[model samples]
Target: MDNSKLPINQIIARINDAAEMAREIISEANIFEAIIEGFNEAEGTNLKLTDITNLEAAQDWIDEFLEKYSDV
Candidate 1:
């Protein structure tokens, strides 16, 4: 799939789907922490999961992260 060509909502949905899969295989907390780490690395900002208040905030982070790291 050419994810970079997808719309923002589709990218977010794919991220959510991957997170869900990770949750089923691992712990949700672990997956969330990993997400936070990826976000921090990709965005060059330190952000813990607790710093995100809602889905919108998380999506914003995901959007920026994808802008930089989608090819990964």
Candidate 2:
């Protein structure tokens, strides 16, 4: 975690790794938001990320949504 003490190459490598991780996290978040929005549109309801209390419930909702509208 102490990138300051690392060599230049190591520091660059760590920075690159952190950037990649950030990109992945952002991508996943975007996908999750899109799925939630799609589900809300299909169901004619307005829901937000705050409405889902836990990851299991979110996954369940996504699964059900996809099962019901896989053709789209």
Which clashing pairs does model 1 show?
none
In model 1, where do residues sit more than 4 Å from their true spots?
Answer: 1-26
Clashes of 2: 0
Alpha-carbon shift of residue 27 in model 1 (angstroms) = 2.7
Winning candidate number (TM-score):
2
Off by over 4 Å in 2: none
In order, how many clashes per candidate?
A: 0, 0
Local accuracy of candidate 2 as per-residue lDDT tens digits, 1-72? 676788999888888999999999999888988988988888898998778889898888889888889987
Q: Please write out the lDDT profile of model 1 over residues 1-72, one tens digit for every residue.
A: 899899999999999999999878668667777878987786689888778789787778678766777788
lDDT at position 49, candidate 2:
74
